[model samples]
Target: MIRHIIAAIATLLALWAMVFMYQLDQKAERFRQIQEIIEKSKQEVPVQKTTQPIQQIEESSVEEQMKKEEDEVAKKLKALRERAGSAMAFKVSPLYKQKCSSCHGVNGEGAIGPSLIGKSEADLYKALTDFKSGVRKNYVMYGLLAKMSDADLKALSEEIATFEEKLKAAAE
Candidate 1:
């Protein structure tokens, strides 16, 4: 009877030892997996750093594109303003269109009215003002000049200056 009891105790201890060994192996495998995950996360750090430069490049490219578009818009606006200034000076002035165009031609190469292409602002202002104030009377120009305001006269003078500059540049 004592021998049988000893044999049963030995069998239980063997089973317990086997179970503990298996659990230890499982824990070691889990630790190894966790170590592999940590290593993989470390490797991704360099990749994240590299992506920062790419993001900066993209941002700079967007800024460059916006700047290019703004430059194009500014160029177009300048061209339009230049064209309008030329038109106002040579063709679209109220006096030119209403009274002078019939004799001065569209660009002030005169048909009956004198060519006013290179006239100074002071001369033009004096003539227009005299016409307005009845100091220099003309049946045709007096009515038109009297209707123009000071702002209109100034704008016309500026347009003439712009036209002269454009002509000078073109001649050069």
Candidate 2:
């Protein structure tokens, strides 16, 4: 009976050893495959010597394209500024100068406020009335127009409506 038990234990130990060796061999094979992939990726593929000149030409062309784009953008900005009237050369009423120019700009080209240059007299008058009556919600405009009479509002609107003409005349 004792001899039988010892043989059984030895057989079980041998089986466990065999399983551990097989697992270790599988892990080593996986490690080898990963190392081969890394080596392959790190190897540099050589470029043809003739392609170097072509690459330089392409790079210079790209730089030239960028410079042309920048020049076009600058020209467009200059034209836009000229069209918008860069200088406030026209005279304005004292009432408008005092009350409107602070936020609307000297030539009504807009500063903190929206541009008032292209609006019609009627539109300007309506907007002024709306602001004064609290139909529109700008606190600054409401406060400014609140104490003004209808005549003053109308005069301001008419003057503002002519801002585009004034700018054009000044530019000429």
| Local lDDT at 165 for model 1 | 60
Position 16, candidate 2: lDDT? 51
| lDDT tens digits by residue: candidate 2, 90-125 | 777878766676567666877657889899999999
Q: Tell me the TM-score of each prediction against the true structure.
A: 0.40, 0.50
lDDT of 1 by residue, 1-172 (tens): 9655765664454445445434533454555465567456643212222358878787677767877976886676556545333322323465445444444444454544576678788777777678778898554555455678977776665555455565566446
Where model 1 places Cα greater than 4 Å from the true spot, the runs are: 1-99, 169-172
CA lDDT of each candidate?
Answer: 0.56, 0.70
| TM-score (C-alpha, index-matched) for candidate 2 | 0.50
Clashes of each: 0, 0
Evaluated against the true structure, the overall lDDT of model 2 is 0.70
Give the candidate number with the greatest lDDT: 2
